[model samples]
Target: MAKISTTLLAATALIALAGCAKKRPAVLPPAPAEQATEVAPSGSAGDVDPNGGPGSDADFRRSVQSNTVNFGVDVYDIDSTARAILDSQVEWLARYPQVRITVEGHCDERGTREYNLALGDRRANAAKNYLVARGVAASRISTISYGKERPLALGSDEEAYAQNRRAVTVIIGR
Candidate 1:
């Protein structure tokens, strides 16, 4: 009985090995599903404008034109500068009442993070305040302070730092 059992076990092992050894057919998987496009060739990420094309609100590129204000002495301020930008931003926004924008306030890395954050906040607030004054609905604009976390010019030089410290206006959801 023991010899018969041993022989059966050996046969079973051999059968399992044979089954595993058979070569399965190599299959070329089907190509991934392609996205449809408008105006361009099919299967492309083409120009299906989010705002339905030019002269639309979503299609408008929010401009961040810069202006410098003298705050007396060499100790100039960016808060007022931001306010000017926001004033213009509001005017443009009024034309497209449905548009939303975020005011990103940044500063040079000369100061501590906490101080910079506060300063950046003030800067954005200044802009927000100006926008409010200029007849822009407060809800249409949002503010954020980068606080030197993201430097426009990555260098220790004053020139670079000056450029780094700025308020940028960005367009939000359509």
Candidate 2:
């Protein structure tokens, strides 16, 4: 029984390693099952367009093209596509000055928790700083690092890892 269990563990580890070795696209879409967008409490305010625009985060999410951005395996830098998305977010934020948001930094199940946490911070700040530089209020934005805690894809494959490594802008108090 001991030998059997050892063999099984070895096989599982080998399969996981093989999956990560496979080549994959640079940028893959977020997991189909994972809905990445989130909204904050609107308080007693009804779901009306207080900003004369999209009333709720849901409406705002639908109005824009994409809500989340992807990152490289261990990278947190924002690419061109990410920049465009942030531009849109800045526009939305500017429209809704009353809104506040939190940029969540995430990572794939690779690297140590400490390392990933630091990397995740860089990722979140990368996005937040871009927005602030573009004129979004720094006070309204905040950051958090969830380092591999919240994975969109539940596998050891590169594709799964790619999906997992991302930065999500969640509406905290809109």
Which candidate number would show the highest TM-score if scored against the true structure? 2
Model 1 RMSD, rounded to 1 decimal: 16.9
Candidate 1 structure lDDT? 0.58
Which residue ranges in model 2 land beyond 4 Å of their true spot?
Answer: 1-53
Candidate 1's C-alpha runs over 4 A off are: 1-84
Q: Using lDDT as the measure, which candidate wins?
A: 2
The 10-residue segment of model 1 with minimum total lDDT is 29-38
* Candidate 2 C-alpha error for residue 113, in Å: 0.9
Total clashes, candidate 1? Answer: 0
**TM-score, per-candidate, Cα-based:** 0.57, 0.69
